[model samples]
Structures are given as C-alpha cells and as structure tokens.
Target chain A: MLKLDKVNSFYGRSHALHDLSLSIPKGQITAIVGRNGTGKTTLLKTIMGLTVKSTGAIDLDGTDLSAQPTFRRARAGIAYVPQGRQIIPDFTVRENILMGGFASTSGRQVPALVGALFPYLTENMERPGGLLSGGQQQQLAIARALAANPQILLLDEPTEGIQPNIVEDIQNIIIRLNRDEGLSIVLVEQNVAFARRAGHHFAMLEKGRAVAAGPIDSLTDELIHQHIAV
Target chain B: MLDTIFIGLSVGSVLLLVALGLAITYGAMGVINMAHGEMVMLGAYTTVLASIHLGIGLLGAIPIAFMVTALVGYAIERLIVSRLYGRLLDTLLATWGVAILLQQAVRLSLGLAFFGITIAGLGTGLQNVRVPAYLSGVISIGGEQVSLYRAFIILVTILLTLLTWFIMYRTAIGAQVRAIMRNPDMAAACGIDVKRVNALTFAYGSGLAGVAGVMMSGFKTVFPDMGTPMVVDGFLVVVTGGVGSLMGTVLSAGLLGQINGLTASVSNDIIARAVIFAVVVTIIIWKPSGLFSYKGR
Candidate 1:
C-alpha cells in the first residue's frame, strides 16, 4: 500500500536515513524494530513528511507523496502517530480523539465509526487529554489514527512507557485491527515481546539502514540478543 | 465599591480583547509575537482611516477593521512570523523591530495629533449628560457614574467574547485550531493544514485587536506609545491566564483590571501599572506556569 524508494532523510549535516527503500504491503501489520539512534522513528517521520527527506520518492498506492506536506499525505489516507503520544494536553479526551479523525470529518460515516471504537470518548466527551493515563493515551492515539480510515497507519512506539497490563490491551487492539479490519500498520517498538504480540512480520533497523528483515519465525535468539534485546 | 467593579469590568474587557489572541499565537503556538502590540496599533489605524476619513458606520467598520488587520496578520505570518516561529527569542526581537517600524510609519502619517472620535451608536438614553462634544457622557450604574460609551463597549466585548468561545469550542474549525495549538504534528497528521490554520489564528488575534482600536479611537487619544502600554498589559494577562487556557485569560483579565483601576485611585495612574506588575510578580512566584497552565511543560 505504501512504498519508499532509495529515500534519504537528513537532520542538518547528519544523515538520519541512508538510501532506505522499504515497502509495506496492505492488510497486515509491518513491524520495524531497532536500537536507539538507528533511525526507526526517523523513517516513520520521513514517510509522514514530518522530517523533510533529502532525496527519494514516496508513493502511496501510485501517487507520489515525497514532496507533499504532512497534511497532504494524511489526507491521502496515510495517518501517523509519532513517538510519544502527541495528544493535545489541554483538549478534552473526546476532542483529542476527534482530532485524529480530522480527515474523516469530510466523510459521511467516519464520526460514527470513530465514536464506536472508544465509547468512553462519546461517554466523557468533555474530559481533557491530560487527565488520561498513559495506557488510555496510547489507546486514544491509535483510535485517532484509525478514525482517519487511512490505508496506512504509522505508529511510532505505541507501547513505550505504558504499564504491562495496558500493554496487553494495546497489543490486543493492534492485533484486532490487523486481524479483523485488515489494517496495515508500521509499528516501531523497543519491546520485542509486545511487538511480537502486535504483529509477526518484523524489519530490524540499525545505524540508519534496514539491516535485517523477514517473517517473524525466521528470527533467532542470537539476533534478538545482539540487535534488539538490551 | 460598585464604581471599582464597573471600571474593572471595562478594563478587563479591553485586556480580554488584547490578550485573547495572544493566548493562541504565543501561548499555544509557542511563538513569542512581540509584534502583537503593533497588530493592535495597525488595527487602531484601520479605524482611524476608515471611520474619521472614509465615513463608514462604526458597526460596519468593525468587520472591515478585522479584515484589514487580519490581512496584515496573514502577511506577517506567511512573509515573516512563520519563518521565525520556534526561535522564541529571535522572533521576539524581529517582531519588535517590525513594531518599531510600524509606529514610526503611523507617527509619520497620522502626525503627533490627538483627535476625538465622533460617536454615532449612542442611543437617546446616552444623550442626556453634560459631556465633551466627542465624549459619550456618563451613565448611572449602581448609583455611580461611568462613561456611556465605555459601558456600550462592555456590552460589545461580552458579545464578542461569547462568539470567540463558541468558535473555539463548538465549531469544526475551532476544533482543528485547538488541535493545532495542542499538537501541530498530530493536527497535521489528521489532515489539518497547520499553516492555513495558523494564518487564520493570527488574523483572528490581530482582528480582535483592531476592534479594540476602534473603541480606543472613540474613547481616548491615539498616540504612538499607546500600543506599548496595551502590549505590556496584554502580555501580563495572557501570562497570568496560563499558556493555553481561554478561561484563564478571562479570569486574569478581571483580576488585573480591578488591580489597575483600584490602585490608580490610591496612587498615580502610572503607578497603577507598577502595582499591577508587582501583583503579577507575586502571583507568578506562587504559580510560575500560570493560573491555567494546561499540562506538562
């Protein structure tokens, strides 16, 4: 559903992503794993147009989106939930969720669909985002991305800093979205256990490049200990 | 006293208009818009040229004032402020320069003359007092005398404030705007055009200042230095209210207004500002973030 060809992104003189070419097929979860500073977040940011790519072509389906602004890509069915739940602190819980479905506002049935995911949003529509716990925020963030009804959802560390109990909930949510709705996702996670639950497909990034990638069953304990398990 | 309350209310309304926009631009966008004061000045000048020179109706001129000043704000954001945003201190210095240039231009064009505004909206209820030709005269409220024009101003302000709230909370555009203010990236990821929303926000903030300028022109003398005083108070109000809280701005406006009005009677009019500032300092010591700081720093 999404393709990045020889895409190179930069932050000033430092090259964050080097000739990174990756494609995410539709109807399944695609996990991108990496150690710190390996450009995992940078890759998602590049796809979202959050960080300007120095060189490459990004195409969603067929239309080129490398030059398009972040908003344009989102409107084109590419929703990104960046690292750290970027929930508006002051906005109400419902308001935060409503913001996720901004692209859906133009459609006829999106509001109803979004409301169906978290009835609590419809329940406590006035509660601010700051009042929610980390787990709730994670749920709100993913629910928001789902609201857009996007072809691709870029989730950068959804389980980071979340409690273990909530981790299971988030894991179930991700699995359900992938299994039932055929939601395509690019989940960046540090916890292999949680990432394992979220999806079976994995791509390991190291030092600004996609070093190793394949079906989850092909990975061994040695690779996990060396690259991912700190 | 009732008199103090009346004065405070009017003063609060003025502060509300001035700082209300800043709550979003600076408080939310994190852009220290030192040029905010100049936007107010520009708004005042719009009224000066439109009402006194073009002979437009006060009610009609209000929207025109918003449009013209909003255009200036849009231009400033697109051509200038947008580039400087995020560099808080640099944007501040750059905008101050823009402000100085605007003041000098206004000073050159309008000359150093203090002229009175002709009042047209005052009904027969306001025509009974002994007042200056330009002055709208005093109205009896709580057995105390206050300028009828100022009272009328209070009503308009209340109406405008209500409208502002409705737009911020109830409207779809407002939801998008608050989203931008809350988290620009998430807002963008949600398919909101942050730049466009930002321009509209700037225009809205500056436009409110323009409305206040029309009132100031009608009530008091328009001097180059007027923007400085209003700006100082505006910064204080938005600061006291909290970074991104509309309710905080409203509450601080009343608190600061009463402090200025009551203190002015005991001390010199100039000293009132010093007293207000002292009070503000004291408040900040107790609540550094603000009266309504939304969440984590």
Candidate 2:
C-alpha cells in the first residue's frame, strides 16, 4: 500500500497542497476526483517528488520515500504516467517502452506484457513516438509504465484528450490492469460516471484538500455537487 | 590551393575537438562552461610535463593528458557544475572563476612554494613541445606538400569523432545521455540516473578538450593565456553550427576553417577573423534555432 500522511506540497512556496493525507490500498482502483486546479496533479507530483518541496510522510509499502529521489521511487515500484504522456518524441516506440525498464531491478528489456497488450507498438518498434496518434501515444505510455514491472500505477487523466472510441478501449485496459494483473492504481479522473464504474474507492478534493473520501458507494451526488461540480 | 585546403582541414579538426565538448555539455546540460578551454590548457601542460619529466613523446602524452583532464572535469562537475544545473548564468560565472584559478595555478607552478620544494620545467613561462622525427616535416601527397603533424591531427580527430558517434548512437550509456539531453525530468522518472550520466559526459568532454590542447601544443605556443582564445573559438563553432547538433558542429568547423584559411592566404589574419565573425553573425540572424535543431514530440 502507498500512504501519504499530512503531506504539504509546495511549488517554490506557492503551497499547492495543504495537509493532505491518503491511504491507497493495494490491488484496487482508487479514483481522485475534483474540480480543475484542485491539486489532483500536485498530489501525484508530490508522490513522485517532482514538487519544489514537500513535508510529511510518503510510505510505499513499509519504507519511507520522502527522502528518496524520483528514480529511486520508481525502483520502489511506483510507475507514473504523467498528464501529457511525456514520452521522448525522437525516441522510437520500442525505445520509449524500454525506457521504463531502467527502473526495474531485474534489468532492462521490454516486457512480454507490452507486446501482448499493444501489438501496434511492437509492430512500429522503429517508428518515432511523435508519429503516433494521441490514442496510440496513450497506449505507448501505459506500455512504458508496464515495462517497469511496478506494483502500483499512477495515471493522471489518461484519457483526457483521447478520442471517444479509444477512450473505451483505454478504460477496459485500466480495468484489466487492476483486476487481472492485480495491480493497484491511483487514477485522477475528470469523468465522474466512469470513475464510479471503475473505481472501488474515491477521494473528492477541493482547493488542495480532500473534502470527502470513502468507498465508491459513499460518494454521493451531494458530495460531487459540493466539491467537484463547478 | 591544395596545401591551403589541407591547412584548413587540419585547423578545422582541432576546432572540432574543442567544440565537441562544449557542444555536448552546453547542449545537454544547458551550461555555458567557460572553464572548458582550461581543460585544453591542462592537456597542453600535461604534454610539456610528460615530455620533460617522463621522457615520453607527444603520442605517449595523449592518453595521460586525457585521463588527467577528465578527472579534473569530473571534480569540477561534482563540486560546482552539479549544484548549478538549471542556473545558466551562475554556472557561466562560476566556471569563469574556475578558469582563472586553473590558469593561475599552472602559471605559478601550483603555488608549490609554500612547501619549499621546487619542481623542474613547471613554473611561470612559455613552453614548446618537440614533434617526433617522423612527424617533423612535410610529406608528399599526390604531388602536393602536406605537413605530417597536421595530417596526424586530422586523422586523430576523425578517429575520435567516429568513436564519439559510436558511443552516442550504439551504446546504452549513450542512450541514457541522449534521453537526459532531451528531457531530464522524464529521464529521471524513467529511472535513468541523470546525475551520474551527466558527470561522465562532462568528464568525456573535458578529455576531448585535453586532446585538443595536446594538438595545439605541437603547432602553437603554450602559455597561461593560451586557453582563453580557444574558449572563444570553440563557442563560435558551437553557435554557428547550432547548439547540440554534432553534424552541424563538424560541418560548420570545416566551413569556418576554410573561410579563415582562404581569406588569410589572400588577405591578412585580422581580415580573415573579421570575415569569420561576420559569417557567424549572419548564420545566427538567419537561423536562430541553429542549422539542425531537434524536433520533439
């Protein structure tokens, strides 16, 4: 399990996240839903140690990760797919996927899971990542994350700008990852209905603070209207 | 004309060695390493020391000089450059300070006077390296006269450039370095150790500069201020060729060297220098992103 206790995150003293605490359970999907600029992204970056500064405890499994650098955090089995899918444009698709293998303790190689899930990436192994469509890029990002062989996946709006048809395909992939692969996932999502459908637990954030958090059944429409609805 | 072209090629080769280090460090880390030329100065001094003390020839000083400069580069990166990663101006200033310290250290024989022990052939003076008997004279090449040492310089540069290309394009460390060059944060996120790679790269670049120094020692006067002008010439090549583009650096060095050589033969050194500067300014104004800027996703 990954846990954040009273974490306060800052971006050069702007104070993006204030006294936030969360427990993301193992082998389940936890959706973080909130309005725009509500620190959903900040939470993810804080976990990755990408923020300007942060205070408090970030424990992955039994170890404290607060002092660890980003690369070490990756080796600790937390793979992040950032908002913009920051894959190297000049790197080939195969190279992009293999990049994540750097974090794996076992050594570097594209996992068999990547080839099984996205045959398109394997087929266009020599093609530059920039040539791929948005939907394809999303697939590449997930494939890249999977190469790390991580226990938990942190996805920040994986389908935000993807096409409608590809969105359903991505949604199914997330479910399969959580259920079949038994991987824990923290998904920061905008689509409330999809969040309710896929997530077992939910956290509602407001102005950088969690306003409501519990099982998906406890996420009432009233709570959504109070915190998320703009 | 052939001799002039050969001279230009040899001159361009030395410039290529100097600029390659600056290109990689500046392009990858966004650092303006003003002390880069000091690595060259150190390399030339290494040759002088090795020849006088160890009784070795210029060829033997090559690897020794490379190792010495690379270690110094590593220390500089770890001590100063590493902390100032994103601060371009601060790095420029700090490295410039380092350049002065290095120059003065060599000039003063490392201030070893405090220990009351003096070493031979070391303190405060101009030094010259003797070319071996084989590389001392002009050689006949297809009815044209060519300086053997100049030819040696060109060959050494070509071999080193090819080695650099192989390292960057064919090795795993090269991939990691390139990945960091493009996106340091993302590279770190992917679990590549950006800091380690950067330090190694800085050392390698310094090593190349040291080799350039050795080359210069053979043909030019070696002194405390010798590296100051080399830094200027190196940056000129980097800017005109485009920052971070290896091919751009190679081609531009050749172009500028030819321009300098041809102009100097017809006119004067001052006029040739003025012409080279004018051409660089024109290139900068014309293509600000450089001749071959990398396109990102």
lDDT of each: 0.77, 0.91
**Candidate 2 chain B, run of 10 with poorest lDDT:** B113-122
| DockQ winner | 2
Tell me, per candidate, how large a share of the native contacts it keeps. 0.84, 0.69
Best by lDDT: 2
- Please give the RMSD of candidate 2 to the true structure: 1.4
DockQ of every predicted complex: 0.69, 0.77
Candidate of highest TM-score: 2
TM-score of 2: 0.97
Candidate 2 runs further than 4 Å off = B114-118
Q: Write the per-residue lDDT of candidate 2 for residues B1-297, one digit (tens) a residue.
A: 788988888888989999999999998899999999999999999999999999989999999999999999999999999999889999999999999999888867798855765556566778999989988799989999989999999999999999998998788888888888888887787888888999999999999999999999999988887999888999999988888788888888899889988998899989999999999889889998777667665
Chain A vs. native, model 1, TM-score: 0.92
lDDT per residue for candidate 2 within A119-166, as digits (tens), equals 898999999999999999999999989989999999999999998999
- Model 1 — TM-score against the truth? 0.89
Worst 10 residues of 2 chain A by lDDT: A221-230
* Model 2: per-residue Cα lDDT at residue B56: 89
What tens digits encode model 1's per-residue C-alpha lDDT throughout A1-230?
78889989998788999888887888878889889899999999889888744689998889999988888889888878778887777777676766767676465123564465566656766777778888877777877787787778888888789898777767777777778778788889887876776666788888888887777765567788888777
